[model samples]
Target: MKGFFFFLCFISFSAFCLAQQAYPAAAPLPKKNISIFGRGLYPGDDATYELLKKSGFKTLLLSSFYIHADGDLYSGDSHLPIIHNGKWVGDSAYVVRVKNLKKHSSISRIEILLEGRWYGQPPNTFDFIRDWYDPSKTVPGIVTGIGEQSTLFNICKVLKEVLGADAFCIDDESVYDSPSIIAMGKIAAKLNMHMTLCPFTKYSYWGDILRASDEKVVDALYLQCYDGGARNDIKDWVTALKPQQPIYPIFMVRGSFGTCDSYKGSKSVDEIRAQLKGFKSDYPAMSGASIWQMDDVKKFVSMGCAVKNPASGTATDVAQFLKQLKTTFKREL
Candidate 1:
C-alpha cells in the first residue's frame, strides 16, 4: 500500500509541474496607457479589431470628425455622413463595432475627434464654428434638438448619447479661432463630455483656450511630435500648456502608405523608441504616447512593408510598432 501511494504521488507531482510549464502566468499588464487615432477603424473589420483589442491601447480617438461646409457632420476621409440637420445618419454597423470595441476590449475611452486642417480650403469645421457660434446668444437648455438647437449642439448630442463617446478631441491645425474653440469647449462641457487637445503649433492659442476653460472641461493634451510639429520638444509643451492632465506625444509610424521611409512625421520602430526614450527622459510624467491613425497601420500591413512575418498580418505589424511604445513607457521593474 505504501509503495502504491508513493507511485501515485510521484505521477501527480510530475503532472503538476508539466502543467505549470505549459501554462505560464499571464504577464503583468503595462502600467501606462497607449492611445491611437482611428481613421480607418470606423469601418474596420473583425481581424483589425482583434489585433487592436490585444494591442495594449487603452484610448481610441476616432478621427477626422468634420463639420462640412453645410452644417452636416461626417466621419473619415470619405466623409461618411453621420449627422444631417439634426438626425443620426451614421450606419448602425459602425456604431455597433465601435461600441463593441469599448465593451469587449481594453479600449476603455472613446473620443470623437473633431479635426480641422487646411487641405484646400480653410478647415470647414472651425470656420463653421467661427461663423455660427454666437457667444452673445445663450446656449439652449434642452440639448435634445427640440427647439433653438445649434448644429454644433445637435452634433455633440449625437456624439455623446448615440455614439457613446467619452470625450471630444480638438485637432485644429489651422483656423485657430480661440473664441470658437473656447465656446465649443464650453458647449461640450455642458454636455458632460471632456475635451482633449491635439496641438501641433500655436502655443499661445492653445494656452488661451486652456486658461479660459473650466478645469474639468479640458482633460488631456495629445501633442503632435511629427510633421509640422516634428521640431516640438515635450518639455516646451509641458511648460506652455501647464496642463493638469497627462500629455501624450503622438508619433507617425513609418509604414504609412506602404513606404518605410520616414517622411511627413512617420518614424521607424527604432527611431520611435529612441524618441520616446528621449521624451520620457525629458518628461517622466508623460502618461502615454499616441500613433497618428489606423489607415497607415493597415497600409503598412497591406502594402507589404518589411514586416518579418506576414502570416500574422496586421497583428504582427501593429505588435511590432506598439510593442516599442508600450515597452518604452512600461513601468520600471
Candidate 2:
C-alpha cells in the first residue's frame, strides 16, 4: 500500500510541473510599431518622397497652413498663390506633381494637418467665419466668448469638409481647458477623424485635464518637446501622465528655443531617433514620433550640420538607415 501511494504522488507532482512549464503566465504584449511624421507642407516632390521613403518613414504629416507666413495668425489657409499673372499657378501644380510621386513611392499613409483655431478671428466667433464665408450659412453667426459650444461644432464641420484630412490635429496652443479639449475630441470622433492633441509643457497644470480628456476622445497625444528645458524631462512628463493613449513625440528641429536650435544637439535624424529611444525607455505606451519639419532638417543640415542635405543623400543611404533603425527598434504592434 505504501509503495502504491508513493507511485501516485510522484505522477501527480510531475503533471503539476509540466503544466506550470507549459504556461508560464503569458508575457505582456510587445510595444507597437514606431511611426514618424515629416512636418511642414510636404512638397510631394520626387526628391521629398524618395528621401522620406529611404529614411523609412511610413507616414507623412503634411501641413496645410504656412505657419510662418505673415498673415492673420488664425488663418489656416495656405498662402501659396493659387494664381499669378493670369496663369492658374503655384502649389496646386505642385500638388499634382506630389500626388504623382506618392503613387510610385513607398509611403503608405498621409496625415494632413488641420488647424483648430481660425487665424485673426476672435476665439468665440472663429467658427462662424467659415459659415459666414459659406454661401449656404447653415450655422448662424453670433458674438460669443472664446470657449463656446456652438463654435466648437462649427470648427469640426469645417475641418471635416475643408481639410478632409486623415487626422485632425488640435493646434490650439493657447487654450488648454478641459471642456474645450473634450469638445474637440468629441467632434473629431463624430467626424470620423483621429485626434492628436498638442499640449505645451510650460503649462504642466493642463496635464491632468489632458489626461482626463484622453480618457474621453483623444486618439493620440503630441507633447511639444521643445521650448521646455531638458529633453530627458519629457520622459518624466510622459510618465506622470501615465497615458495609455498613443503618444507621438514631436521633435523640434528648428524655430525659436527648439531642441535642435538651443542644444546644438544631434543631427535631425539622430535627434528623431534619440527622442523615440528615450520615450521607449521611459514609457512603453508610446506609439511613434513626428518631426517638427522636413524643411527644417534640410536647413539645419545645410547651415549647422556639415552633413549633406537629406534630400541630396543617396537613395541607398536613406533606405538602409531607415531599414536598420526600424529593424533595431521594431515593436510587435
Candidate that would win on TM-score: 1
User: Which residue pairs of candidate 2 clash?
Assistant: 54-318, 74-118, 74-119, 75-119
Q: Per-residue CA lDDT of candidate 2, range 211-272, in tens? A: 55534345556666664423435566666766666566666544223322335333344455
CA RMSD of all predictions: 14.2, 13.3
Misplaced by over 4 Å in model 2 are: 1-39, 42-46, 64-91, 94-106, 114-164, 202-217, 229-232, 254-276, 307-333
Best candidate according to lDDT: 1
- lDDT by residue (1-333, candidate 1, tens digit) is 999999999999999987644221212112465888988876667777776777778888888888876678887655677887678888777777777776667787788889875667655778777766773544343122212366777788788878788778898887888977888776766676777888999989999988887656677789998888999999999888787777888988766656756677777656777788888888978778888877787677566566553322323456665655556545421
Give per-model TM-scores.
Answer: 0.81, 0.58
Q: Model 1, which residues run further than 4 Å from truth?
A: 1-31, 135-148, 307-324, 331-333
In terms of TM-score, how similar is model 1 to the real structure?
0.81
In terms of lDDT, model 2 sits at 0.47
User: How many clashes in each structure?
Assistant: 0, 4
lDDT of candidate 1 at residue 173, scale 0 to 100 = 80
